[model samples]
Target: MAATVVQLTESKKHIQHTHRVFEEQKKAFRSNTMPSLAERQENLKRLKRALLTHQDRLLEAIDRDFSCRSRDESLIAEVMPSIQGINYTLKNLAGWMKPSRRHVSVLFQPASNQVHYQPKGVVGVIVPWNYPLYLAVGPLVASLAAGNRTMIKMSEYTPHTSALFKEIIEATFPEDLVCVINGEADVAADFSSRPFDHLLFTGSTSVGKMVMRAAAENLTPVTLELGGKSPAIVSPDVPMEDAAQRIAFGKAFNAGQTCVAPDYVLCPSDRVQAFVDEFRSRFAEMYPTLRDNDDYTAIINERQYDRLQGYIEDARAKGAEIIEINPAREDLKDGTRKIPLTLVLKTTPDMKLMQDEIFGPILPVVAYGTLEEAIHYINERPRPLALYFFGYDRDHQRQVVESTLSGGMCINDALMHVAQDDLPFGGIGDSGMGHYHGKEGFLTFSHHRAIFTKQKFNSGKFVYAPHGTAAHKMVYKLFIR
Candidate 1:
């Protein structure tokens, strides 16, 4: 078919372009192995300017891509964080770049030791569709701050945003210093397989596995920001209204299309109905209506829309109580891809809603008899990217913090930990690995090279040639003991 031939031709062209840009970035990084502090700051400043200038355009593009992404949501979730991240990086880049002095061992007297954070050449960022601009720009800021040339791979699912992002990036920086690649799954596979100095991927865990496997072929170090079933635990004593309001905001923001969004809530058995009621009330207050609410965001596409709908049906069929919080009770099935904030009660372990990451406006409330039971439930499963506890008791908070392990945690809050400019954001186990944001971001993209300086000392030489010398014996006796 002619369509098939054209598709093949386009694929081939995208592949070729990716390869060419990757080589160009590597070559550019080679020429300037370490950029000065002022240079890095300037680069970030330029990026900030571009973002501010194209803020409206970027919002429109993202809205078009998602069919009905809220303009304010896009600005808050994507644009604001991106610009703020750049500002954070610019302010702290100089301190981050300074070589850190290390204490030398007594055995190596008269030697100075330090670690030099050098750039890791070219960094490849594979952005996901959920929060395309933030994911792409977050890692790009870190890579640039670390003085590395970068090539970004925008998600094909968000074609409008991807094209606009590529255009903006190209207009701002030279192709060799910064490049953007737009293509489908095959192109993403090819991009991951390329020999980038470092790669950062943000997406689903399954696709993250494929990206990691591809990067392994080149031995490329990766920072994966994968998503999982992040859970929030509501304490028996904490005000249900307080916990519900926060969790509702987390779930309803961008219609819950967030990597760190609360996937489910683990509440005390007695307060299940109370917690659900509060959540429903808070969500209704936030949206009030879904059909024509520009404040609410729609699912990204029909496929994703169908997937979430199927989840509701599957859970319903499996004996879970379904509660749809449509305040106005308007018809949302008019091809708008808008789904009200739905709650699934009494979800079983085997249900798809419980087993997988629910990256939508669906929240499942699992009732736990006690705090220990809640902790046990979380520990029995793969570690999540984020964990939330909503109790005011300091001892209980400490117990929760000390007992569980996750990429990040929030006490008395949800999803706000990620917005903090100073905290390092990442995941563990199935959720994800490695970190970015704050100083960790700079460190992730940098190669910490140890440096030892010995001016005229021969301390190492004293024990180099002779095996049984007096100095060696003294050294062994004094320090070894």
Candidate 2:
């Protein structure tokens, strides 16, 4: 009973803290409604410097949280992309901030139309645990680029990294300009419920729905970067060795915890065994051992580890052949949470592995007799966050691009599209709702307020009143047609 009282008190305190910081940011934003190009550029430069300065600490902290996340992976996937995003924003922000002129209709002569990109007062970003630093910093970069102050909420599962990130952010900027919030699910709910000009969330689809519902209370706009069963299609013509190696790299990176990781592979039916064999060989070459290999990352926690194990056990029990790619045949019962690259073959739709997003190192290889069958299989399921097609044929690529829909696609590659600073990153339908990264990100956190001006001429006055005068009639007759 006493614990319940303590819990309520702490909840109230968190709510108060969130509100206090939000109001402070609001007041600060009102003081400088529109920051100049120079100011925004300086902010970006400072952010880049801070990130680089703390790069080592961030890598270590994330490593601690994940038990043993690969330092190189953290640098390549998290830090490098963040710095590149900032550089891209700095390069294009000046032109992006300029008001775009629009053609005024003849009927509205003597008037000019243009769109002014203005900052939304305060933005809320809810970061996920998968890529703690990248997810938090990515949205923060876009928010600051748009001249809006941001309050970020980090995932509780990554306590070490979240705390370290909070320190980095505090040292980098004043709290009123940008701040970080750390807590559990309840705290996240409170953070999302607060009225903000815009909100961005990166996590699973289920949690995204709850975040959207909370945002709806204040009619807050949201950009959800959710995950799904993203698939990689291996064309029959492509060398099994080439396709298998690339797919292995994608699935093995970060232990396949990435939101856009290739969830499963659709390989040619006749080459299923060959692809699996090549995948196993390629993965083995990457890491000959798992438990002691620092290059291999552990599952974030026991719960996630057990969840993935459960998927494999369930599939095995349901008659799905399980191939554990442990080249060294190391016993996994040790304290290390590293699970080998397990492949489930002959999988049926009723299995949980097929029903859910396997956000782990587990890969399911489904067989398809023809290209149309592969495309149809993907189309029947929920649209994925990313789709990978391995082929040199331009016509097949074009057909895949036109006939199906996904947030992003990679031709003859995997997981590289999200790294492009110029392309928008996001999902569609059940996967997610919106796009961010590069210009789309800046626009997401901004309000493109449309404006029209007249040069001391009341041309609209002719159509204003007097029950449709001759001028109005003429204007209407000309434009109404």
- TM-score for model 2? 0.97
lDDT of 1 by residue, 306-342 (tens): 9999999999999999999999999999899999999
Please list the residue runs of candidate 2 whose C-alpha ends up more than 4 Å from where it truly belongs after superposition.
Answer: 1-12
lDDT of 2 at 338: 93
The model with the greatest TM-score is: 1
Q: What is the C-alpha local distance difference test score of each model?
A: 0.92, 0.92
For model 1 the TM-score comes to 0.99
The candidate 1 region of ten consecutive residues with least summed lDDT is: 457-466
